[model samples]
Target: MQPEDLVRDHTIYACVTGSRAFGLATDDSDTDRRGVYVAPTALFWRFDKPPAHVDGPLPEQFSWELERFCELALRANPNILECLHSPLVEHADATGRELLALREAFLSRRAYESFTGYALGQRRKLDADLRTRGAPRWKHAMHLLRLLISARDLLRTGRLTVDVGAEREGLLAVKRGEVPWPR
Candidate 1:
């Protein structure tokens, strides 16, 4: 079967991600879609297995096979974990709903490392950008702070929330370069 067909016909979970999912979207924000699909059992009988991920039939879209998605989620990959918790799910079969229900099972104390580690990496890049460019890219700086906040809240609450909620304006201020980096 065609790869796109897997996402088209076999997808079990799909949701909006990126700035839009975080409630930080502006008029120019691009819609980033992420999803998980279960390949038909029959397809595995062949020597060539179904792909573990697909890069989209639409612009800025990507999907992982269910097994791969689960593996990443269990490892607390920030992106995959956030996708499962996104407030805007576009589609979900019974399996997808089950996946949502199982979201909490994927969380563990280990996320403190995974999320913070990811944020730390981003932070270094932003620092380097500032050193070389005289200013960090406002958009990347905005996202780095957002990610650091998300990691802190997740570790504190044992819950994952993507929306900036009340912090939206402060973050938007950062994005607009109104907030100084030293602050």
Candidate 2:
């Protein structure tokens, strides 16, 4: 089946992510959408299996096949875990709801390692930007700080939450470049 067919017919869960889902949106924030689609099991029997992911018939939209999504989730992938927790759910069928119900099962102490590793990688990119452009991307810096804080709090409390809640203003300040890069 075509990638779009998989998304259009098989997508079981879909939600808004990025700044909007994190309660960090400004008037111009893009609505980043993510979702999971389950390819028919029989598809694997074919000469070519389904694409593991699809980039979108909609702008800024993307999705993963169910098995791939689960594999990543099991590894405590930061982006997949956050996608499952996004509050701005746009679509969900029974299968999708079942997947959401398994959100906690997909998390563990491993988050500290995965989230921190991802943050460190992002930090390197920011560092490169600092050297090349003379200024780090303020938005990336803000999100990196936000991810670290979230990971720290999740490790401490055993609860994963996407919204910044009380830290919204300060994070937005960082996004606006009001905070110094070193700070």
Candidate 3:
């Protein structure tokens, strides 16, 4: 079967991610999609292993094979961990639901490292923009700060929160370039 067929036939989990899932989407924001697919159990018995992942026939669509996904989440890979916790789920089957139920098992103190590392990387890019443009990408700066706060709260509370909650207005103001950054 073709790779897209695998995703179509075997996709076990799917969600809207990025700004949409983060409670930060504006009218023009792209819908970022993410998902995991489990290759049929029979596929592994063959000499050729199933593909580890497939990129979309549709824009903004991407998926991972289940085993590969679990491996990354076990290592506290920020993207994978966030996928499991995304609040904007679009589809999930029994297997996918079981995987979601294991979300906490996949999270550990290791996220203290991974989450902060990811946030710092984004912050660096925003800083670079500030250096060259006399202003940072305020939208990116806002997301970086949001990510840092998420990481801090996760470390302190051992809970993951994908949505910005009551902070939506403040964050959107940043996105509109209304928030000030120190020179």
Which of the numbered candidates is closest to the native, going by highest TM-score?
2
TM-score for all predictions? Answer: 0.95, 0.96, 0.91
What residue runs in model 1 are displaced by over 4 Å at the alpha carbon?
Answer: none
Runs of candidate 3 exceeding 4 Å displacement? 45-48
The model with the greater TM-score, 2 or 3, is 2
Cα lDDT tens digits, model 2, 121-142, are 8798899888999899887888
Better of 2 and 3 by lDDT: 2
RMSD of each: 1.4, 1.2, 1.7
Model 1's TM-score against the true structure: 0.95
For candidate 2, what is the TM-score? 0.96
Scored by CA lDDT, what does every candidate get?
0.92, 0.91, 0.87
Worst 10 residues of 3 by lDDT: 141-150
Residue-wise lDDT of candidate 1 within 1-183, one digit each (tens)? 999999999999999999999999999999999999999999999999999999999999999999999999999899998999999999999999999999999988778788888877878888888889877878877878888898889888989999989999999999999987772
Model 2: weakest 10-residue lDDT segment is: 174-183
Q: Which digits, one per residue and each the tens of the lDDT, describe model 3 over residues 77-111?
A: 87888789999899999999999999999889888
